[model samples]
Target: MSGAHAPAVVFDAVTVRYADSPAPALRSASFVVEEGELAVVAGRTGAGKSTLLGAVNGTVPHFTGGHLSGRVTVAGLDTRTHRPRDLADVVGVVRQDPLAGFVTDTVEEELAYTLEQLAVAPTAMRRRVEEVLDVLGIADLRDAPLSDLSGGQQQRVAIGSVLTAGPRVLVLDEPTSALDPAGAEEVLATLSRLVHDLGLTVVVSEHRLERIVGLADHLLLVHDDGTVTDGEPAALLATAPLAPPVVHLGRWAGWDPLPLTVRAARREARDLRTALETSTPPPGPAVPAPPAAAPVLLEGLGISVRHGDVTAVDGIDLGLAGGEVVALMGRNGSGKSSLLWALHGTGPRSAGAVEVRAGDTTVDPSRESPAQRRRHVGLVPQSAGDLLYLATVDAECRQADHEARAPAGTARGHLDRLAPGIPGDRHPRDLSEGQRLALVVAVQLTAAPDVLLLDEPTRGLDYPAKEALTRLLRRLAEDGAAVLVATHDVEFAAGVADRAVVMAGGAVVADGRARDVLCDSPAFAPQVAKVLSPQRLLTVAEVRRAFAAPPSADGARDLGGAGGGAGGSAPYPVLGGRR
Candidate 1:
């Protein structure tokens, strides 16, 4: 209640240069976030967003060993003078990777760990932990082992742990990146409540702008050049290079005020809808049928993975054809990642037959050596760090090239192509979240395996990076490689995947063409399809393709139409098999 009108966070011409860096990561940046304000930071990957967030808690220069100039103050405490540990009571920083921040084994203990370290009174700590558990709606997970929790649950626990400390300023880095749509909505709604009811000054950074843009009271754009732009969300998004489909549709339709949410777009889309009523634009291409001679790259018969008494993956029969891209989608702990690992033969499988075919040879991946398995079916795990070991990016790529028996720079070449701006001398751990995933993916791709599996490939990627990844995967699929991507990004799935396989309770619930499956599913539909429902429009690109000059004097074009409901009255018939 005190200092309510004061700025909770202030960056006064802050400049940060990391060790051995060519230029400053963040240069001459200045911004102020008032108390109780929900500010969202948006930028491309490796664009100094993390540096800005770290500055608030004094982690950038002090903990990260970066050269800092100028001043950053959180809750009137100068970050330069106060170490992160000292400022922990006022500023709670939750990292992009929840596992990195988790220190305790159980959810309850994790939540209480921060308060315990601060030496808060026993009774106060207990009350705070219980309040956080209920606030995050994770009461059921209080006694659950943190390791056993799914990615989304772990993320919620991480946030709850920080919340238990009762920091005035909450700083989160990509808090909902791993969450499903419903989980993301829940987390954002919780943040909104905190800002409104508790008046917490929440500063969050997210690459998925569509989900957070509308929730933000203020917007800060971190450009790659280390400059910053601060303004209202609608004003910043009007000219932002990377934005959601709804914003794109609003821009294309020339709405007076650009809409950041689907509800806003629906309200402003009446005129556009009327214009498209007369035009019956042809639907986009259907999912291509598998070739007649299509070799089954990877096939699983009666696949099941069990952990203790729980069956993570249960009796799932699936096949991935050459030259096909399939998306594995579901909520947290739905066995999508479990099945990916089991199919790649890395995880423990109680009962399964995983046979991968290359040319005239078909071998069970479960029995093959690591090297042979990499050559046959390469898998990039959800934690990409699992595949990286070398100190530097250059060293890792060289090791990958050597392991694949390729030229010295072959893997490095692949990495450069996948992520162009990544510094070769930088450590893999030093790279951005998106950059690290890209490096691991490119390293695996150097083997040129027949089958490629990626787990949550678009976690921290910006729209442009996601677009690049989409093109890369499509090209790989066209080159006769079988690509299986297990992801929470429904929009990315809608873009790159030909076939979609939805998992629930360790079994395949729905498997069909991307359009047919996503259009009908409420939880999986993209923003564009959600706004322009009943029209089968899935992407902004699809809407652009269907654009035609309206039969009017103003010379405007009919961009798209609206859908009836969440499931959408869109008559896209289901395809393929379902459980």
Candidate 2:
């Protein structure tokens, strides 16, 4: 497509198939990204999105041992002839997991590692490293340990590390999945500035489409059949089933062009707001369990976690009841994961009483063995792959069956229920980010513990997969399992959580109903909530119901059922003790 200057990246009839795979990951994929353009690739989990991004930087066939055909070019360099290392000067690759890309301990060292490998001169390397550190706004973290930085900070460093190499084209896969709203904004802003000022050609694949939809110049949609539809974001989003809440609102309100950002939605919200004036919404679903003297699934009293001089989690008390779904929300390094690990009894716990109560049997996680603790409480780490070890999916399932004392094919059955299309014989590591998480979750569910804990579970899932997970969690809660999820996905929280807990600086700041806390909080509110502010609405479903209800003389609506507003104190609902 480039008449004079060559395109930044090109995929010419490229198809990639993994070893022993039934179908190709990507088939007949062809596209050209012009110089200084920003392209976003989107798709469902296991739908060949990552495979396509890998092709651009030459990591598909070379690093991943896949059968490759056709051709891929980056900055006029053919990827087929150049391995990822060979094309380091032309293309930069940052993975979904930022921790995996770190090779040095400190932020400054990590930025310089690439330049050192390329054997840049000392003076030039120093200048480049400083430039990138400032460019990504990580100069403050130059001497900080990579482990000490928060998830968002670490991600910025990862980007800066690759940036020091001065690659013309940058490819990132789900760069903002683990970040909080503010952190995600920072990353996206940096990318936008790079594209405009530095003239960097960027291709990023992200599941959280709302963050990037407004900034993208081109949209590449990869489908389950391994075909891609490239077009403008607005046109594609008009008909896309996996669109964000703002887009859905636009379709419902009949706006000429869908609003990709909250500001645009707000500007168009006046007419819809007037239509909803006299509408009264129906009642919300009743919480399944009534106040009863049920056994507590999990409890923590004065629990604390510390590393060196830093107290990650302070003295805190928390509990989870059977049939309760609670969302732990906070900014990065806010001790959500720390509290979860302490409750599961897998990580360090300096001081606290962590207990799991099931059918009159009380087990202290600190005193129980690994198997014993797992039987009562199951935890899926942020790195889901860490929990999977067997060679084949079938073998892993079989081993889980044996370990959990589950019936024959029980683990496999659960795996099928959670993620249906995964092959039993495929290796766990080879699966996509979403599929791998599904496998780990299914494995943990096989134990059928009274309490389930998940950390950032929706990192790489598409909208469809996220909806499935939401349904699955609801079902688990109905089955009397206490589900605690530590996530930054506000939309997922609104859909799944009945109660919301906000943590900050290792302390609980707010605990209330999902609607109130989510609607009231500024940073954690969903897009729809911001668009329809002052109404305390948390989801598009609410808006639909509000509009569908009968109109009254006053034109008022009340969508209430669960606990009241988010600003009350109810003694924090103790668990495992009394009803």
Candidate 3:
């Protein structure tokens, strides 16, 4: 925590253009970060966030074979003259992909790998690893196999590994995208402490603004057209043109100039406490869905899957009726992915019963070949966007349409609904994770399959994108497409699904109504469920209704309108000081 107050990094009109890419990924990006402060960088996917970060450590033109046109310096080191390893002494980078950080067999070994490369003494390495592990609160997982730990644990280990190297600044990209809420909170809180107490310069890119923006001292907003907007964290988030949802609400409500955090939103919620004089919530339209008649049925008896010697899924029973929205819920490595793959015949299925009814015929999922199941089942895998290798987003959708033999116009309609802004000639693979996800989902929807399976469909999505996807899924289900989603986002599952199924250690432990299964059941509830403690309140919208009083609940003055949960129940937790 002791050093001269150094300028951490500077970006001088930097731009990144790859050999294969026609245009620059980053269009003249410029920014700066000072030592011992938290700076948050945000953009819609593919808006040059990755390119800008890569430029900071000289990974832009070096690892990517791109044209770099400007000077970027990190911690007094000219990035142009330094390779990644050479800059390791000054700048630490935690990549967007947690998987990218893995190098050794065990978590402890991975942490040690960097220290040894830096040629630090063995004793010092040991002490630094322990310090980082204790600070990140993942000490128990230090001995665990790196691949066996959950995504959250792996991410913590990734950050801890770099922090242990004793760099002046830490640069992280989308650090919490793959983590559950609890894990995300843990990582953010740790970073906040490191910035305030340990005097580490922290720069992070994230889509979950509600949680992290408040903790930042500086904020950078990147527009799709390559504009970099920077200012004090409160000013950019709460009052800027592209302010996030909570920020917009806080600002419009005339809350103290700008409320950055959720707790601060509570203090500005006075308007919501009054009963509404006239205005009412817009009527939520009925989402689209398949026909009410035909349904896909997946009545399972037992199934198991083995990768080498490991059994990913073992002996499980499940049912999926037509026009049903069912969520396959579990933590990482709980066999959720294996189950979805088993149903689609993509993964090895040792033994099990999976009956999918299409009209008069009932097809056994395990007995069918990959090609055969592809005709009937539509699958959107976890990390599904990684598989895209196409030139144009339009071409990506066309591939599915061609396979489906559906109308060519159906593909266009889906594209319009999903990503109207995407150029027809834009490379699908070059897009950001969120943008690619939209393309993938839109393509799959064009296939018109009777049964749909979405694996972690919400990754990389902002609050609005998540809501849009939920609406799409509800529509698909109502149309009689049997939809099952494998996800770590349990709160999302509870909102969009009629039934919830929990998988742990490769088996279904709980299954029932969304609210009963997620909120009432002790073992099956998500972390936020325990905190909210309200019956069947699966979303922030549902919780907000408690604040919308018409005439008066206790003869209070009617307040016509307030944003989000302003009128709802008191924000405080009634039990155990949890919220």
Candidate 4:
């Protein structure tokens, strides 16, 4: 361990260049992370954030086969002299895709695998495993199979496996990306406890800054040009290109020393709330009401999905119409994914009937071949990498073009729009999680299915990538494609979905307009909504549009408290229409 006065980790003019890359992944980066501090690494997609974290454990040069100049020292051990395994006792690293790193089949076995490899005593290993299971709130799943666990559960198991190893420095890459809001809070709270109580150092890279910025002691901004800038969280975020909704709200409202959390933003939004009391926002674009006899593009009747004895999706009826985007939301393990898979005709369904209207014919996807099903329905599962089998990005794109009989560069064109600058020759496995998802999305778009299902598509996307995806989905909807996105990202849901469908305990609990459903739920509300509560504002863009317009004649009129009118019956118009 480092001395009391020494920093936990240090980078001295570090530069890493991959064999295939044109420029250095990290160029002359230097920073020191103090002990017990939580440092968040933020950047655009494919901006070398992972490269910086990998350098700390010597994965850059030793494992990734990169040329490294300068030096990285962790816990007083120089990475140039020590490989990842050699520094295992001091540093714990978790990748964005937890399942990729998992070595065991069961949760208990996986958690104990690390300690057993370290040759810890049997009693100690057992005790540590139990402690981690409890700390991560996964004790009930201790004996469960890893394959059966939800994406969020798998993430917790991955974290638990590392914690049992007792590393001093924890480096997590998008640790909470797969988790629900409640689960993410638990994991982040556990990290905070470790930082404050155990004096452990944490360096995490996350796209959703809203969840972690409030707890971050320091921030590292990895620019697109491969340079890294480090400072206090608030100082860096003030001018950072990528920011959460709360920070955007603060900047829009011109609050000095911008607030990073909803609580802080709400505290500073007193005057703005008062100003918005009576001045109603402009109305949204008129949505053409569906005719009483409008035909549903896709319909599921009595859908029931089961895995072993567990009921993932109960009997439920759902319908998707053309030219609509729906956000499927629920806590982790809440049947959202199962329903998507069942609807796509790829997962287990004990009892259900899925019918899709393609052209003039109504067809059941389950009875069709994989290729036949693609023409009517397409699905991009949570593990997007599973869809790729080619050696290089170019090969994957070529295959997708051939399968869909699309133009030669059609898939590549979609990819370029979704996430620009991905090298064609790069192997699919070598791409980051966000890049992999983009590749799959591009491949699926080649089919141009009537209905598109994406599960956790924003798991690894940065803010810009998410915005691009939102625009793509919106365009697809406008082109008369029904889109269903299963996600835990409330912010993305608020921005992209016209309708929100919430599931819980394997059943549909609520379904309504996105603004009404998202703003009404405390657990699912976005930062902007939480900050500007009772006004029903869902996004920073909405708030900006509201304030940009001229104040109404009755702007000073008070309609009860901040809620506006009795029983909140008055409509709060947000920036609407196709986002």
Candidate 5:
């Protein structure tokens, strides 16, 4: 046990290098995380964030076969002297890929697995399992098969399984990447309570800063060169390489002590909102109007999917025109992934007619062979790594090119564009989550199908990688392909999608322009839209463009001089309080 005044975790001149890689993943990184503090690790994808976290529990050197110099001490126990199993009682880790860590068949059983391994008494184990299930709001899924549960449910179960062990320090990588906005909020709230009420130190790595920034007490930034920096969240984020939309907006508006939450941003955005009262944001990219006789690139009629007695998709009719990007969103388990899989023809589909336009003939995708289907429609599933089986990145690319009958380096070209600098010789399993996702995306694009479906494509991507993906998808749309992205990321949707579709209870509940669908819903709105409500501004780039453009001659107002008053009340009711 650590002394009362000792830090929860300490890294002293620590450096870690894998045998395969030429450079160290972490280079002489030094930091300290005090007990009960919530430290968020922020960095670009594959920028050593995971390497830093793995070091906390000795996974870096012990399990990953990496060379570790210096030392990592957690709760007064040196990681060099403690294997993962030895540190299990003091440190609990929930990795980015939850399913990879699951060992049980059911939710309740999974939660009890960790406790059972620790030899806890049956009475205490049952109590701990119940507490974790209830705390994570997953008690209703206690008896559900782990395979039947949605990705978000699996994430909750993963966290619950760790919580049942009752460790003093918790480490999670992209914990809420699979969850909906509300679900992410609940999980973060639970973590906050654990930190404050239980004095549990938390070190988490997440790409979606908006979801976790407000709850973080400290920030650990890992640079591309493997160096690490730590400080207050706001201060570090103000100049960090990437930040949430709200922070971008705060920086754009010159708000001192940049707001980390929508509530704080709203409080500081009063005058700025008044300044933009008369300026309308520039319109989104123009989607060319399809001719009346043009065939829909992809169409689904009366689609119905079921697993046992549960209806995953219930007789839904949908269509996508060529040269369009659609965002499919909803609460976890609301049928988004199910719908995507059904459309792709691989998942369960009891009833549905999915047709894709192939040249002059329209063909049913479900009736086509996997190879034939790839020629017309392609899909990247939520678990992208599952599609990878090759020994190295070069091998995967080579196979993808061969399967698609494309140029030898075609897939590798796409991968470079999406996430540059990933070594070709590294094994797919060794790459970071985002890198693995990028590789799959590149492989799927090798066929260059007319219709593309991506489920949770941005699961592990940072903002820059997402921007690159956005550009790639836009290029695909411009090339007359139809793209459908099933995602929980509202900001990505706002920026990349031309249309938005919301699903509920296995049916399409809402469908319309992305701006209208996203801005109108409090739960689905992006941080910028939430900060500047009633303006329909969805992104920081939009706001920046709006402010940069010269005033129009017809009643347009200058951003700098629109609101003469020093202080003005927000036009809309203050949105919901802090999450």
Candidate 6:
């Protein structure tokens, strides 16, 4: 068992670069994971986070065709002479792209394939699969067709398959990238369980820090130039200025030794409240909560789509107005995406009302042309870089601006805001996922559309990236943009959206304030909601407002962002609820 503080893995002067490549993905990288500890690895996509993890299981050069040097010892064995299979006794891995490891069509079959390779007895294999599936709460999916499963569900199957092998060290690469809010919650819960119950050495490479921040015993930050900073999660986060907004906000808000959990945030708020008591009372009455915005008004809608003879989203009524962000929730195969497409006129929706009132004109989506609709609506697809085939990031934005009729330089402002150091000559798609998302958004913002739709925008982002995205989207809404995000990230939705709507079987199930909707529905509540308020503020500042030190003499805000980790709070209890 990789017990607390018991070293289980080590790396010495590790360096990797593909054959003939100009620069190495990892340069002299070194780290260690104690037995029974949860280690988190973060960097922008393409920051060599994946390459680093692959090195541990001997996949760096073995599977990726990269040049490798230096020693990579896992569980007391050097990996230089060991193939991935040779390290089978020491490590089990889950990648950001679970499909990378999948070859079977059924969950059980996939698991069995791995077990059989290890020569585990048939009886033990079944028992092991059952226990792991139960741990992941995917027993019901054991016989389900792999192709029929959503990305999140598929990842669970992938993870279950690996866990069945009973490797001492588990390394997951962006393991939660594909999960929806509920599915993400399930996955994080399981990782925590693996660390605490099974006492396995767990190493996870991810972008989103909020999910595992509280559970992490160790944290590593990977810079694009192949530089890394390693330390305790809280210590590293508080000092990493370019880190996620939540961490920044936590440090500034003076969260008393700071906290990584909701309960800790709550306690900090209580402390702030005590400080507030020392201040003089205000002359005027307290301010009310923000006002509710008007509902979107949609006229006739006609949509054409077929999922096995059934329309995903039929002719429906929908519209988006100012000051609102809506979460279009639904199971995979539902028409939520189709409805969004129909609204944007990106796809044909046969026969019905589709009108959007902006300022003077009533834009009828059904009657509009493709180019016309694009000018009024912005969209960030699942694969955001899909439309980017350009030679440079600046070129992508410049073209989009030209198409949108905005000033050619309008894109540069947005681009600079999102990525301060990115040059115009850099290829957009070649950047990391977070960078790609930011670049795409910058390009889209040049159009300044009234309605913006994003599909799974947080798919490959780290905690910092995800939080920045939430803040960015919220700012867009505040600037009078109606943003509709199709996401599985309930926490992101809770943090950024003013409104929430869940779609099921091709229709809207419910719609209301984000807090009311998310808190009331577990399926859509963020993983953090298990321990925090349903209004899980997306930023550390917002979290501080709810849980940090009190307002000043005049009720002024404290903006430094300091301290984290519960020096107090009995224990950050695990929560259980179904969405």
* Candidate 4 residue lDDT tens string, 1-579: 454466888998999999978889899999999889999999877789989999988888898897999989988889988888888878998887788899988999999999988999999998999998877788999889998787667877887888899888999998998889987887788888889887889999998999999999999999877889999988887777788878877876779878989888899999888767665453333333554654688999999998888998999899998878889999988999899989988888899899999789899888888888898899999889998999999999999988888989999998987767788998999887778988898899888798999999888788766777777888898788899999999988988888889999999998877777888798898887788777877776666556656665755322211111100111222111000
Which residue segments of model 4 deviate by more than 4 Å? 1-4, 99-111, 122-157, 281-288, 291-295, 550-579
Worst 10 residues of 5 by lDDT: 570-579
Error of 5 at 488 (Å): 0.5
lDDT of 5 by residue, 41-109 (tens): 988877899889999999888988979999899988898888898989889999776788889899999
What is each predicted model's overall lDDT from 0 to 1? 0.82, 0.81, 0.69, 0.83, 0.83, 0.69
TM-score of every model versus the real structure: 0.90, 0.91, 0.81, 0.89, 0.90, 0.77
Which residue pairs collide, candidate 4? none
RMSD of each: 6.1, 5.9, 7.2, 5.7, 6.4, 7.1
Q: Count the backbone clashes (under 3 Å) in each candidate.
A: 1, 2, 12, 0, 0, 44
How many residue-pair clashes does candidate 1 contain?
A: 1
lDDT of 3 by residue, 1-579 (tens): 122544888777877677866667777777878888899988665667777777777888888787888778887777788888788867789976777668889988988898998899999999999998888888888889988787778888888888888888898988887776666777788889889988888888886676588799988887767667777988666544434445644554556666665456656654542222222332222322334664546666788887888888889887777777888887678888888888876667888867777557988755666445655677888776765777787777677667667787676677677656667787766666666777777667665667888888877765445556677777787677788988766545655787778877888787766656777665445433343343333444443443444435544333221112211112311100000
Superior by lDDT: candidate 2 or candidate 6:
2
Whole-structure CA lDDT of model 1: 0.82
Alpha-carbon deviation at 399 in model 3, angstroms:
3.9
Tens digits of per-residue lDDT for model 1, 59-123: 88887897999998887788778899888888888887788778889998999898888999999
Model 5 shows how many backbone clashes? 0
Against the hidden true structure, what lDDT does model 5 obtain?
0.83
> TM-score of model 4 relative to the true fold?
0.89
lDDT of 4: 0.83
Which has the better lDDT: candidate 2, or candidate 5? 5
